[model samples]
Every structure is written in C-alpha cells, then in structure tokens.
Target chain A: MKLSTITKTILTTASLLCVNQFSAAALIPTHDSLVTVPVVSHQVERTSVHFSQPIAASQQLSSAIDSYTGISDEYWIEVSGKQLNQGIDLDVNHPQALIRLSAKQTKGAWLPDDHAIDPQDLSLFKNQRSIANAFSQKVTREQLATASIFPNSSAVKIAKKAGVGKFKLKVSKTLKSNQRYLINVKEKGSAYQQVLFSERQSYLAGQTITVRAAINYRERPLKNTKHMAFIKSPTGISQAIDYQTEQGKIRLAIPNDLPATKPGQLYELHISSQGRDGSSSIKRNGKVAFAVAQPTARMTGNVTANNQSAQIGLEVASEGRYEVSGIVFGYNKNKVLMPIMLSASAHYLQAGIQQVTLNFDPEILKSSSLIGPYQLRSLKLTDQSRMAVLHRNHVKQSNAITQLNK
Target chain B: MKKIVLSIMLCSVLLATPAMATQGLAFIHGTGNQTDAYSDYWTGSFVNSVRQGLNDPNKYTVINCDFDQFMWDSQAAGCLANQLTSFITNQNITELVLLTHSNGGNIVRWVLSNPTYDSRYPNIISKVSKVIAIAPSSLGTPLADAVNQGSVFETSLGWLLGYGSDAVSQQQVSWMNYYNQNWLHGTSGRPSLPVIFKTIVGSDVESAFWDGDSYCAGYQYQVALETTQNWLDSCSDGFLNCSSQTGAGTQWFIDKQRTRDSEPLSHQQSRRDCFNLDLIIKNDI
Candidate 1:
C-alpha cells in the first residue's frame, strides 16, 4: 500500500538512524549467480544473461571482466535486427528491448529511498504496466505470492508481494541503483559494429575530423570487409570517403568544407561496412555539428607608464577582462638594451562605447631595465576568455612611456 | 755580426705572414631566419657596428644565413655549416669565436655537436674557440606551442616572425622537447669538441604585472612584448623563456650570463649588444 506523507517522513528518519545497525555487506546483493533469459524467435541470434540479485554501485570488480559476460554493475547493450542477413544499426535513443526496475520492501532496511533508487528522477511506471504512477493503487503483501516470473507479466504479482513498492521501465538507460531489488532487462541482440567520433564538440568550418569504428563480433572476424564513411550536409550535400584500417579497426578522416549553412548548423554523418561473404553489414548514423565563430570586440587605447602605475586608457565593447600586451624597449648606457614582454588585465564593467583606465606600476613591464624614453611596440588588446586580438598596432614613437623614478 | 742580425730580421718577417693569423668572429642569427647573408639580422648595420666597435676590419665575419627556413630543417643548419667551412678555409682562420642569437644558437650547436657534421666539415668544428649564445632557443620556446595552436592573433604573430604554419608546427612543445633531448648534444651527452660555450639569458618577463605586483620594476619595452609576454609562462625576454634559451639544466655550456629587459635590452637587443664589437674585443679577441 502507498505510504502517507507522514509515514514516508517517519520511515526516512528511522532509516537514517537505524542504517548503521545493519551490515554494510548486507546492503549489497549476495546472490552471485546468473540466470538464462528466454529469446523470442529462431531467426534472431540473441543471447541474454541475468543477474539473480541486483548489483550495488559501490561494489568493486576487476576491470578486465566484461560488463555483460563478467561482473560489472553497469552494462551496454545495443539492439539491432537482421534485414536480408545484414545487421541494422541502433543507438542509445532507440532500443528494441526495455530495462525495468522493480523494488519491494522486505524486513530490516529492505529498500533504499526512492530518490536513491531513481536518482535521475525518471518517470516511474506503475507495476511495470503501461499505466502511470497516479492511476496505480496499493496492494497487500499476500497478493504478491507469485512474484518471480520469466520475462513478461508478474508486474502486478511482484508489487502485491511487497506492501510498499515502486517500479520504472526505461529504454536506452542503464539500470543501476543503490536499492536492493530484482530488476529485469530485456534486449534484442548486441550490435555488430560501433562507430564513434573522436571529437564530440562542434567542429569549425573547413576543418578535418577523425572518425573511428570498432567491430563487435561473437565469433570469427569478418574477412575482406570494406568500410566507407560519408557526410551529408543540411543542404543535402553528400560526399563519400575511403577509410583505412589500423589494427583491424576502421579509421576515416573527413575534411569538412566551408559549411553550407549558417554557423552552429548540424549535419548527418553515416558510416557503413560490409563483408565480402555477405554475412555482415553494419551501418551507423550520427549527427555532425559545426560552427564558425566570430572574433571578439576591438579595443582602441593607449598605455602610458610611470613610476607608480602604468595607465591604460581604452574603449571597450563589453564589460569583461581584457589583456594588454606590449614589449618595453629602452636604451641603456648609449646601448639599445633588450625588450621585456609585459602584460596586464583590466575589467571594464560598462558596455557600449565605454572608457576605462587600468593602473599598474611601469616597473612591472620594465623589470630591472633602465628607465628612459622607451617605446611600446606591438601593442595588442585582447579579450581574456576568447583570446581574440581586438586591436593590434605599433606604438612607435607615439606610444612612448618613460620611468623617471619620481 | 751584421749578417747574423739580417738573418734574425728575415725570420721575424716570415713568422708574421697572413697564413699564420687567426680568423676572428662569426655571428649567426636565431630562429625565423630574420638575417640574410648580405645584411644585418638583429640590429641596424650590426655587422658594421661591431667592426667599428672593435676597431677591426678583416678579423670578423658575419654569416648572413637564411632566416625563413625552419630552425630544425637540415638545410637551415647545412647552409650555416657550409658558410662556416668556407669562411674558415678562405680566411686561413686558425681559431674562431662564434656568437649566435635565438635559434641561430641551436643550429650552430647542432653543427658543432653532431659527429656527422664534424666529420664532413671538420674545420668549422675544430677551429672554434668559444661560443656566445644570446637568448638562444636551445631548449625551444613555449611561445612556439602557442603559435602552432595559436588563435588568429597568435597565428599572425607567428607569421610575423617569418615563420609559416609548417615552421610553427615544427615548434610544438612535444617536438621541441624531443629536439632538445635528442637533437641537442647529438648522440653523445657532450659535444665532440672541447669548445667553451657561454650563454646570455634574457629574464625581462613582466610576470609580476600579471600577478598585480605593486612595485613593478625593471621591465624591458618592446613593441610586441606585452602581447607576447602573456604567451610565455617563465622568465622571458618577451620572446623566449630564460631557461629554455640558456640550456639551464643540460650542462651544455661552460658559463652563463643574464640580462634584464629593464636594463634596456630584450632577446633581440641582448643579441645586438652581446655580439657587439666591444664584447668581442674584450672577450673573444
């Protein structure tokens, strides 16, 4: 039965207090056995393994073990189908089978808080049925006598066995939680090949992108397989490129063109590989995003150096930090000494045709060099974040700063 | 007694012939190939100014090598190596003092340290007496890393140094690290010749200004020093860090000197004054 708000609060408080009384090992599932999952049809090549007990997030396992075949708390399973003996591509967004979690309240800290179980706040489906949470009603523990069933049904039975229970069905989401409960995950088969982009962020116009694809096979490797990659722009522009294999993995380099669309546009990238024996054909599609960014604001200013402070006067577009960089050149003992690199930052809070003055000691830029008539050459103003050179000019004789030591 | 005195005079004249005289100094420009063989690279009439300062005409020779090629390119070092060989052979130079600035120091060191170059043109390596490197990029510059992955302004600055993208690519941090670790001192831990090497380091970086120091003193001024200083993390002359330019930990040199930008000099300016006629006259000669 559904607990009232007061009961939930009392239970929550009691659990927090009595949590230390229970064994830390008891919080984790003890059953270390796997059960076989029944498959649908003979035409499909499917393999499914089930953990008799739920796995906890904190449990440590060997990294050498695979998530599916070994003992990882997390696993990745791709769902694909056969068309004329060729494999279809599937990603996280579209899963053929669903993974659903069901929880029951047993004696002594039987279940973790619902918040811990579904930390992502996913919408819970009532009793693993199509009905949402609002329409579901509480059931007595005597009603769930037959809770364990194979793949389907028993949703209502499991809920009836536990007086307080909650369940959620998710597609393309990994089923993991701190709660100790029985979870059923049904997936159509594994993907034969996976293609991924080396860089996830958006690319710039006229840039080269690197793509990598790895083949996943349960049996023998594909012989004489040909792989190809293509990019289809938003304007329906398509181009096919050849790929080279390195250590049996396909690698392709895509040289993007000046983007036909505006900045921050998206395109479609597709890759397909087929074996000569006609037994394996894999195709994967991904979204390609790129942008052409503009430079930051331009700065117009002159800097003067004195004994106490170097005054910089400039007109800035935005109210942010700006870096003023220049080289200090002076004469020492009738010899033209070397130049030192100087840089300082100033923040302009006001925007739109604003003028600001930044003060810094001239000696910081002069750094043990003699003080005299010095010229600041290659003066550049740049935005701090974007590092865009807003203004660049040679101060020559006009941008002269002298340290009289006064 | 008159015949014996005449014999001594004849012997003294023979000993003072031109073939016995030692050739003087050679100046090599650093990275970006800023100096051509026909003109001064660092300062205005630098070759002539040094000659005048030393009050010597025929003793010193400046190698106006190509400045546009990548410093690591074999041709860049080969062209310099060829000039040193020809200068030594033609001048009947018995001993030579070498002065190099920036990347030029790297190339000269490569030619001297490499056994292959020493074997090919033995005179250039064997005839050298001392070397004075000013703000050399012996260990490479972090600015090169910035330039290779540079923004629009950084790229422009890199190009301004007479280095294109390809040349900037050669200056990446990994490449420079590898070059210093492997390319320098050749295959051996030390150079083949027992040459005495001196380094002039420029530490005029306004790093304090970045930290908002109140008493900002002793900064050397250059046109691009400020903009470029942000690109450098360590003590710098607005171009290269002091440690990289000086080969600090490599024990590659015999002695080292430092100049501050506040002292009215920078990487380029130090090269100018360091290789000046006064310095050559005082030390090399």
Candidate 2:
C-alpha cells in the first residue's frame, strides 16, 4: 500500500532537522520537501539534478550503502563535488541543502560505525572541512550521525566518503552558503520468526500439536539462536512449554489439564528465539492461535409448534452448526395415519441460548378437524460439525395428543 | 344383592392366590438413544410386533422401558435400574422377564453385574426369571470397534442411530472387552447372577436392509455392512456380527449346510422367531 501524499508530508516534517541559521519553520519546505543544508564553500559551481519523481532520500542512501557493503539502513554522506577539500566552506546566509531522516525509517541500535572505532576517533566534514564536536565532550561516531540544531554545533561526518550520509547540524554553526549537501538515512529491518500450525484442523487442548518456524537473522548469531515456545491460556496466563525440535519442526503436547476454556476462548501459541552476539542482541517472536475442543455437549430447550406460531429455544453447550428434524402425525386411535414432515430451520449453536422460530405449513393440517390430537414424532437434533445426531426427542401420542386448532 | 356380594368375594379370593403369578414382561429397546421421551423404543410396531407374536396379551403384562436421555452411558443404566425396581414393586410382579436389544443388553448386564445394586435392589434382581437378549452386544460389536478405529461414513445407518458416535464408540470391542471382564466382573469377581441369560444372535445379512426403512437403505447399508463384516471376521445381521451378538463364552454358529434364506435373522428382524419358542416358559419351570 502506498502512503498518501498528505501522510508523507506529515511524516517528513516530523523528522526533518533544522540548521542554526534557518528558523525551525524555514527548514521544513525546500525543493519537493527535501531539507537543504548549506555547506561551507566559496564560489563553487553548483549543479542540481531533477528527477521525474521525488525519490525518498532514505531509499537512495540505503541502495548506496547496500551496494558498497551488504549492510542496509545505515547512514551515509554523498557530496556531488569531486574534490575532498580540507577546509572548503559555504555562505551561512544562503538556503542550502540540509540532511534529513525519514520519520518512518528504522535505524538499528546505536553503535560505532566500526567495532574498533571509538567516539574520539570520529571526524565530521562540511564541504570536506572536518569539524569538532559541538559539545566539548567527545560524541560517539553513532551519536554524531543525526542533525539537531539545539546545541549550536552538532556532528557532521563523511564517515565512509559516501555522498549521502546522516548528520546532526547545530543551528549555531555557520556555513559559507551557496554550497549544496545531501544527508540520507536507510531504515533497518528487524529480525523475525514466522510460526505456523502443522495441521489445518481445530485441535483439542490436550492434543499434541506440531509447529514450524522460519528463523530470520538480525543481530542474533546464526549458531546460538535458542528456540522457545510459550502458550497463553484463555485466562490471560502464560507458561513456557518443553518443546522438542525434530527435522526442523517444533513439537509439544498441550497439557491435558489446561484450565477450562470460556466461550469464544482462544489459546495463543508464541514461538520465539533469543540470542546474544557479543555486543549485539536479537529477540525474534511469532504467534499462532486456535481453540480447544469441548468433551461433552449439553442441550436444554423446547421445540414448540402450532399452526399459528412456532418457536424453538435451544441452548447447546457445544459449538457448531446443528440441524433439527421431526415428523408430525395426527391420529384418531388404531386408524393408520400418514406422517407429515415438520419444516426445520437450522442455525449455528454456541455455548448459550439460540432462539429459532419455526414455520409449519398450515396446509398440512387443513385436512384434519380443529379439535383432534397430533403427535410430534422423532424430533431429532444433530451436530453437523461432527456429522452425527446428538439428541432425539419424540412427543408421542399420549403426551402430544392435543387439539390442533388450525 | 346378597348373591352379587357372594360372587365378588369369591373372585377376590381366587385373584389373591400365589399360584396365578402376575408376571411382568419389560421390553428394553436399544440403539436409538436420540429418540424422544414417548417413543424412545424404535417404532410403535416394535412392541406391537412382539405383542402380536407373543399372542398372550392377557397372560403376560408388557411394559416398554423408556430412558428419555439421549446418551448411552452409565446414567442410562442407573435410570434403567431404578425403573426396573419401580416396575417390580408397583406392578406387584412375582416374575419378570427382560427383553433387551443391541446396547440395551449392555445396560442389563451392567445393572446385574455391578454388585453395588445386588444388596440395594435384591427384589428386582431376584424377580428376573429370564433375559431374552436379541442381537445383544454383550461382548461388544466389531462395527463399533471399526467406528472407534475411525471408519466414518455419513450415509451409513450407524451414523443416524449412533447419537454423535459417542454411544457407538463406547461400545467398541476393546472397551467392551475391558468393560465385560474388568468393570462388570473384575470389580470383585462376577456377582451371583440368578437370572437365566440366553443370547439370540442374528446372521441374516441379506434381509438386513429394506427399501422403505426409515433409518437407512440402498448401497449405504450394503457398504457399511460389508466393511463391518470384515472387522468381525464372521457373518453379520447388518449391524453386529453373530459372534459379537453372542458373548465370547458361547460359540453359537449358524448351520451352513441346511440353512435356508428364510431363517437368517437380521438385527431389525430378530423378533420373527418369537412364536417358535415359549416366551412365558416360567410356567413350565
């Protein structure tokens, strides 16, 4: 799904950083909403390339970093000019290109660019001029990555000599002006574990269940990812399960005595793996949900029908669709009678009351006199889910003999 | 007036004699647990057929034992036990005969062998002179065993009268194996059963189904019966095989040589031989 243009504008403004010379309001809109930070330079020939579509600065930076190193969602700096001048400057009065980070971008945990590189060893370049940390304290290379104007001087660096990189610029810092710069960011992807049930049918709680997961690498070491499973019962309680992995699948039997499940209750299975890779850590999680099968079904209700009005209030303890069927008969003693079929209506029965209104054709009773006896024979209830009849009730001649005032 | 009083006194004195025993016949119909309160025992003609065949409506009083609950569990047995005791006491019955069919035979066995009732309802137990079980699943049915092993066909007759398959599955051969020797007799050895038990096994597969049968018919019953026969390793009466209908102790085999098609007793038509034997044989005993 594409983000609406209005949403993109709102997100862009929320994360864009302001430079010292430009007011917060002035830093918002530039050429197509790209923050233009002024670079320190003197009479440099500047050129601007216009693309048909306004490309997201983050996307461009991510591709550049990935092409150089497999690493993505890392900050990089890209300067259009060829020279790496040591002290080149830009006019501070002019509105120049500023570095911006997309609000939606996900940057991985803050860490030094290199495992060995310390905060003191970092360098910042504005138009190729290395600058000091605005705060007297040595800012970590990772800390100097973003542009913020509050402290007057913020870290700006060409960490990898890439033209597009992230920088934190202070509002107090002066630029020579008329110099173009670009600051771009790439959003990091989180490690994930996708869990799925091995079987397609609804399982009883005590039934043994097998699940499989696709583990994706993030910060966790490939060898040491500890797989674990947890079940959250219907009662908002969770406990770890002792699971065994065989042939790339996780299997465990749901405890037989799991607390009784309430109506519409669901048991959620959480499969996750955790590992620590020296200084980096990763926690991957996945989830699947199912309901527990009930052992017995209890039904309580009455099936009442007459020529004028008929209704059934059946409450089945089991869950699923059920069908009702019966036969209607009128007799005057030993005389043979043809059985009349009762019009049955079907509905899904849950754990509670299910009221159904039945309509019997008045024409079936038209032949008999109004003051005669009738019998509701073989009134049966069947569970369609299990494909079996659960209950049978017949109002025989003795009790069912009543006047059919049709 | 004096002559009428003298006639009434003489009639009362004759009715009170112990020689003219008031025998009660209880028909325990089975298999259709999903049946309603009034007609829990199959069709009305089932009892009528038995009555018509007995040809002794005046000699023997018949009562249909109806357990309204739909599940065939111990609860049904408990209900039957209570009804039996009540019927014996209320009807002033001196001798009672039990006629059980299908899983109803299990209910009778449970009541008789469950020792817990031996002391409580000694009268009802003592009053039972004989039990005539028709296609009784006393040793459990192989068809039930097949259902427990997961042979499910919706078009089959067992699926309709089975009541969610729970009742049928409970009567599986293995469960019945455990139930008969362990639960029934295994408690503290078999209780002293005073009643004489004779099981009538049916081996009529051809007449097992009828075209207009309300339960099931056609290729469905044929396929179900065929598959079930393979499980029993013997001939069947459409539902249970002959070996299962008769308990494991007695080996009653249908004669293969002199048998005619007319003698095969399917589960539904097991009552056809009612006239051949003396049902009220207690008078002779």
Candidate 3:
C-alpha cells in the first residue's frame, strides 16, 4: 500500500492503456501520481484523529447475529473496523470467525491505535467532547452516539436471558384433513395477569368459509389489544368467532372440512389481527409470500472425483414454481472451496435434468471431493430466481439417480 | 399499622405463590400451513417443545387461528377469539403467561388492543399474566419495503386484503406503519404495550436471509430502530443487528437447554387445533 509506488505503477499502466485502447484509458492524470498519493494520505491522516479521545459506550450485539457466538448459525459474522469506525456490516467479503474494529487517525502512525475494544476496558466511549466542539475534526460526539448504542438495547437484553422465552398453547392442533376443523384457545398458568398478553387467528378472503374469532387478554388495562381466530371455506354457514375480554382464546373445529385454492379459483389466503381496535393483515405477497409455500423442485448429491472429472446432476418435481439448483460437494487439491453456481427456477422438473460439467481449478477439489455426495441445499423461495441458499439441510432428494439437472 | 399490614400481606403473596413461582404460558403460530399449521408448526416440533415448557398436560392447548395468510378473513379472527374465550372459562384460567412468535405476536396484539368483540368472549384478557413476543413484526418488516415497491409479495398481500374496499384489509399497511412507529414510541392515541418481556430471536444463520422472506433474526429490532430508533437500547437476539434492537430493559434471557434452533420441541413447542397445547408447556432452562 505504498502511495508513491502505487502512483508510479498506475501512471505507467494508464500510459500503457492509452496506447492499447484510447477508449479504455481515456483520462490523463491531473497531478503527479506519486505526489498525489502522499497528499491523499496526509488528508486521510488529518481526518482520522476526529475523536482521538475514546468515548464511553457499551458495544451492544446486533439482534441478527448471536452476540455470544458471533458466528452466525449458517454464516460467520466478520466485523472490520478502520481506526475507530467499524463498517456497518461489510458482511460480503469478510471471512468467518473474524471480528473487525475500525477508526481513523490524523497521523500515519494510526495503526497502533487500531484494535478491538476490550469489554473490560471501561470508559472506552468516555471523555468524548460534544460534537459541536469537535466540529473541526468532524468527530462529533453526537454522531458517534448516533452510530453506536449502549449495552442496554433490546437485542442485548435478550442475549442476557438465561432462558429463551417461548409462546405457550392452551390446546393442540385439531384441524383434521377431510374431516371437521377443530380450533381451541386457552392460556397457560394464571400468574402474570398484570402483564398483559392475548392470542388471535384469522382467515383468507374471496373464499367462503366459516370462522370463529376471539380476543383473550390479561384483564385490566390490556383490554385494548384484540386477540382473534377465524377460518375460511368456499361457501356455507360461516363459523362464528368469539372475542372476550378478561378471558383466554377458546376454539373448536368446524364440522365441515374445507379444500385449498383450486386451479379454477383465483383466490389466496390471509390471516391477521387488529390490536386495540386496530388490525393488520398478511397477504400472499411480498416479504411473506415465501411462506405461502410454492411448489418446489429438489435435487441431492455429493461431489466425487473418480477419474480426473467431476460430474453433477439435479432432479426436479415441481408444479408452477421456477428455478432449482444443486451444489456438488467435493474436494480439490485440498483447500476448502464452495463454488455456488446453480439455478433452476420457473419450471418443474417432470423430466429430470441431470448432468453438470464443473469447470474449476482442479487443485481445490482434491480436498473437497472426499466430502461425499452433498444432499443439495434448498433455495428459500424468497427469490425464485437467485440461486443463493435460503436454508441449510433443506434440499429434498430424488430416489431416482440424478445428475446435476436444472 | 396500615403500612405494616400491607407489607405483610404482600410478602405472604410473594412467599406463598409469586408470579415467578407459577409458570403461565400461551402459544400462537405464524402464517402458513393448511390442515393444522399452528399446532403442527415445524411438523409438531415447535408445539411439542412449548407444551413441555408449561409443564402441564392439560395446561396446553392450540388456537388454530390459521393466520399467516393461511385462513379466510373475518372467520379466522372470530373463531380464534371463541376458542380463547371458552378455554378461559372452562379452565378457571387466570394470571396467564402469553407468548407468540412472528405473526402470532401480531394476532395477540390485535386482541389486546380491541374490545368490540369482547362481549362474545367475556373476561378473556383478565386471565392473562406475563407476555413474551419472539421476533414479532409489530412493525412492517424492512422486507416490506420491497413489497411496497410492488414486488409480487406486496401485491399479493394487498390483493388479499381487498385493499380499497375492506377497512380490515386496507388496515394492513396503515396498521403496520402505525404499529412500528408507535409500539416503540407509544403515541397519545396508541398506548405502549404492557408485556413483561419482548423476546426476540437472534441467529444470523437462516434459510432466506437476503431474500427478505428468510426467518429474520432481526425481525423485531429492525422495526424498532426504523421507527422509534431509541426503543431497544440494548442487544438483540441474533438475526436483528444489535444496533437496531438495542434499548432499555428489553431484558434478554439466555436459553441453553435446546440443542439447536432447529431442534424439535425440546423447548415448549405447541401444536395447533381447536386447542393449542403450546400455551401450557414451560421452558426447561
């Protein structure tokens, strides 16, 4: 990262590019690249010391990543910081198991100041001046406060929980297929009424069906929150729903069983609630459409290198959805490698498409090939297009032998 | 003398049967599922774990509200309320513990905030006690941004709600926006929620993270930060970035009993039906 060397190299490259393709390297250096690098370096140094004095603030863990483990269940969290200002995420290129810290210094010797703040180190965010006083440095304390949070956030509180809080049920699932639909409501032990809580249920529209509604609360001031329940059908005597204050949700399955949306029907499903005289509904689109459960295709296999070639295949069995992918698990020359590149969406695999020619640096596969045939991962329907993984250990397998098929 | 007497009485109640001594719970499921989604959530793993948490065989029940855009409107809410009312009446239920995951949290809030339907199910709220919300999207999810921008999911939700015509349907966006802004802020019109714990999930490892439809670990905190930036002033579960969900005593309780987030109902899980059994179980840890 030497500025003078970089400048000279860039100038040489640009000059060379000018002769090779004028359209490609169309710009001329405004100043000596060598001199400009140092000047820019000096500017960076000047801007860095904005907050030389460490401020006091507890680093709170984000809600999305496990604070204790830091490593995500599927992906590890790699934090990087320059000087004192850590990037918001920088999740993409960072390696797993790495914790990054950042901050800028107004001097070239800023490297020594760059390090993770030790939890035991108190007053890390202390002694910081008001942003108004630090205006020149642009290290406004207010901005820092805005950028960082204390340890008292909700995300941290949950991290402190000795037990993960869970929702309780009063009864069991009784929605029988091809039979009567039975829904029940109830509350667990009677101990925390002062702490208000309730339950609800709902149904989709445009379809005819019976539904029962209810609102269960913990008495007193919590009366505003509305808890409910309901069901949908094509058409018939709609089931009556109940909502009672100072009570718990109670339910019973309807005597008639209903069918799902058929081909001829242009209907979708929905369920929601109105809290304290207010209700919101979820539709079969956007942010939640994936929950609708679209027809999907699955393929499973592992990476193997018998000869000098590795072949992959995918199997399909979907109905109206698009896209599918398969990851061939294997080893190359020994370094861990995962080339995520497989996409099959929009059409079902009635005709199993199997066969993939993996063009890769044979070196990386030597170590991975021993891993065995990988049971392909499933792509969360959030994007029926992106081959990106949605969840792990989710790919459905085909009993019939399949090569990498789309 | 009066002060002494009151102190003694309070102490007796505390020593005899404090709320902490008696574990109360309620379970509600998110969207999706056909035959028995709520109860059978995660193929019954979730419900089973919740049932064990209540530590009562009969204490658990299922309210198959069938929300999750999985049920017919009007009817889903009404039936859910009925089931809740009957159960409270039948079980001498009082001082209950309440908990919900994802959309279930929204359903529970609606019931607590509305009373017009209360006549049918009397004193249903009176029996409740503690409240815990897990990854509840009290506010519209950041993923909704895409939906609002006219992604297939947003269009579907809009169409399903019957947007312009139905007040309830049209309320989706309004409610989410209002809820996100006020639940954390608690404006004059919208009072703050009265739950003991606003639990959230924190696990970056998810099925569809970038896709917005993934099980967002930050689902709760993101809404809090976007709306009342100062709401959760502390840390978050795992998925919600810590900065967004941090604030106040949204106290966290570490759960170590379960092997993994994907485990079957090792923690009290509930099954949906006429009775949601998850409402009865208690957590081992």
Interface RMSD of each candidate, angstroms, one decimal: 33.0, 41.1, 27.7
DockQ of all candidates, in order?
0.01, 0.00, 0.01
- lDDT winner, 1 or 3: 1
lDDT of 2 by residue, A255-348 (tens): 7666654332345565554444443434444444444444223223344455533344455554555545444455434544434334343455
Q: Which lDDT tens digits does candidate 3 get at residues A314-378?
A: 33332222222223332234633223222222222232344433322223333332332322222
Worst 10 residues of 2 chain A by lDDT: A60-69
- Candidate 1 chain B lDDT trough over 10 residues, lowest sum: B149-158
> What is candidate 3's CA lDDT for residue A182?
13
lDDT, model 1: 0.40
> Positional deviation of B137 in candidate 2, in angstroms?
0.5
In model 3, which runs have C-alpha deviations exceeding 4 angstroms? A1-406, B1-24, B69-73, B120-122, B151-175, B180-190, B195-197, B206-281
RMSD of candidate 3 to true structure, Å: 32.8
Query: For model 1, how does the per-residue alpha-carbon lDDT over A287-395 read when each residue is reduced to its tens digit?
Result: 2222221223343333344433344455444444445544444445656543432333344333344444333334344344444444444344544333223443322
Q: Chain A of candidate 2: what's the TM-score?
A: 0.30
The most accurate candidate by TM-score is: 1
Which has the greatest lDDT?
2
Q: Every prediction's TM-score for the first chain?
A: 0.27, 0.30, 0.22
Give fnat, all candidates. Answer: 0.00, 0.00, 0.00
Provide chain B TM-scores across all predictions: 0.73, 0.68, 0.55
